[model samples]
Target: MGKSYYYVEVESLAGETICLQLPNDLQGAMRAYRQAHPITWENLL
Candidate 1:
């Protein structure tokens, strides 16, 4: 079976919290997430 990912909603200063999926390797997802949402570093947490 393929790997499964878990997600959780996190609050950010931007306003609406987001549901993030945790992948086995975060590098690619991190890149894509930043590109899709241009939030500050702090907002990323």
Candidate 2:
């Protein structure tokens, strides 16, 4: 088994951070964040 980390979701500038249990799959979270945030391919490099 792997260890668990924490995930924080910030909706607004003044919004409180929503904490959740982060599974070992970081790729999923990155993908989800990329879709939600305005991230470019170049920035990921």
Candidate 3:
């Protein structure tokens, strides 16, 4: 099987959902998430 990844919902600055799942690591999922969805999203849900 493929490597397991974390799941979550990404929210945008306009209060809209951009996508689901960030797939970050213990070091910094938020960091990964931020890098992945830069300029489009503002928060995670």
Candidate 4:
């Protein structure tokens, strides 16, 4: 069986929207997004 992939849409500080292919579920995708971006917990809300 093949591993499932997830699409994570993220925005950069430059205002460019990019789609990332993550090899994980929603929780994993969120973790990847937080690692790739410089956003804090406070910034999320």
Which candidate has the highest lDDT of all?
1
lDDT by residue (tens digit), candidate 1, 1-45? 643344668789978899988665875676666668866633775
In angstroms, the error of model 1 at 45 is: 13
- The CA lDDT of each predicted structure is 0.66, 0.56, 0.60, 0.62
Give the TM-score comparing model 2 with the true structure, all chains together: 0.31
Worst 10 residues of 1 by lDDT: 1-10
What's model 3's TM-score? 0.32
Question: Arrange candidates by TM-score, highest first: which order?
Answer: 4, 1, 3, 2
lDDT of 3 by residue, 2-42 (tens): 45455656688999986566534442755566679987545
Sort all candidates by lDDT, best to worst: 1, 4, 3, 2
Task: Give residue 18's lDDT in candidate 2 (0 to 100).
Answer: 66
Q: Which number leads on TM-score?
A: 4
Which regions in candidate 1 have their CA more than 4 angstroms from the true location? 1-3, 25-45
Model 2 pairs whose backbones collide = none
Residue 32 CA error for candidate 1 (Å)? 27
Encode model 4's per-residue lDDT on 1-45: one tens digit a residue: 643455668899999999987544565656555667756732552
lDDT of 2 by residue, 1-45 (tens): 553344555466787676565565875766556667755732652
TM-score of each: 0.37, 0.31, 0.32, 0.40
User: What's model 3's lDDT at 13?
Assistant: 90
